[model samples]
Target: MAATKKGNTEQIHDLLYQALETEIGGVGVYTTALTCAVNDDLRKEWQGYLDETKTHKQVLLTVFEELGLDPAAAVPSRKIVKHHADGLVAAMEMAKKGGDPSAAQIVAGECVVLAETKDHQNWELIGLVADKLSGAEAATLKKAYEAVEKDEDHHLYHTMGWTRELWIEALGFPAVLPPPEEVKKVETAIGASRAEHARDDMLKHPR
Candidate 1:
């Protein structure tokens, strides 16, 4: 039983470390993405997300301090996370240099979606881990998870909505700008799906 508990604790530590790395990388992704954003609405939205991402990083730093972990400790998984983030930034830079603002915007949205996917999953797992534990550890993780959960959902789902609508517009369809997710303020997977399905009606009604 002791061995099992130790293993689980180690796993949680690794997760927290990876989560911190994700937020750090997320800041970079959002920052570079803003440079590629052509739509004023999208630019404003991404700027907000960028600020939130930075705050999320600080949240994790606090978590690390509370849990007695080194936020800067060397971890193997951190390298892979950084590599993926750097790739996303590089992809956006390539698109931006292609001299097509619209195309670059699309690429940026895709990168944001990718980065937020991992980030959202990290928080979800943290919440799950918190549920299984008790005492101060659970309390700390739960607080951190709750603080960041809604933002993570919004980051992933809304960016996905934006990416899809951007692609549809690029395909020359009558795509809805700002996406239904944004207008409806979706913060869950189900809400995002509903918003996506409502797009046809939105285009028809144009509210």
Candidate 2:
């Protein structure tokens, strides 16, 4: 039993370390993404997300303090996480340098979606881990998860909607700008799907 518990705790520590690195990479991703954003609304939205990503980093730092982990400790998984993040940033940069603002915007959206996918999954796992833990550890993780959960959902789902709509528009369809997901403020997978399905109606009604 003791061995099992130690293994679980070690695994949780690795996750937290990766989560911290994800947020750090997220900040860079959003910052670069903003440069590629042509739509005023998308730019505004990403700016907000950038600020929130910064806050999420701070949240993880606090979690490390409470859990007696080193926020800056060298972890093997963290190096891989940073590599992925840096690659995302580089992709956006390459797209931006291609000299097509619209194409770059789409590429940026794709990168954001990829980064947010990881971010959302990390928080989801954290929530699950928190449910299994008890005492101070559980409380700390729960607070961190709760604080960032909604934002992670919004970041992933809404960006997905944006990326899909942008692709539709690029394909020369009459795509709805800002997407139904943004207008409806979707925060769940189901809600995002529903909003996406309703896009035809949104284009027709144009509210």
- Candidate 1 residue spans exceeding 4 A from truth: 1-7
| Candidate 2 C-alpha error for residue 11, in Å | 0.8
Could you tell me the lDDT of residue 155 within candidate 2? 92
lDDT of 1 by residue, 116-150 (tens): 99999999999988887878999999999999999
lDDT: worst 10-residue window of model 2: 1-10
lDDT over C-alpha atoms for residue 6 of model 1: 34
Model 2: per-residue Cα lDDT over 8-62, one tens digit each: 7888999999999999999999999999999999999999999999999999999
The alpha-carbon root-mean-square deviation between model 2 and the true structure, to one decimal in Å, is: 1.3
Backbone clashes, each candidate = 0, 0
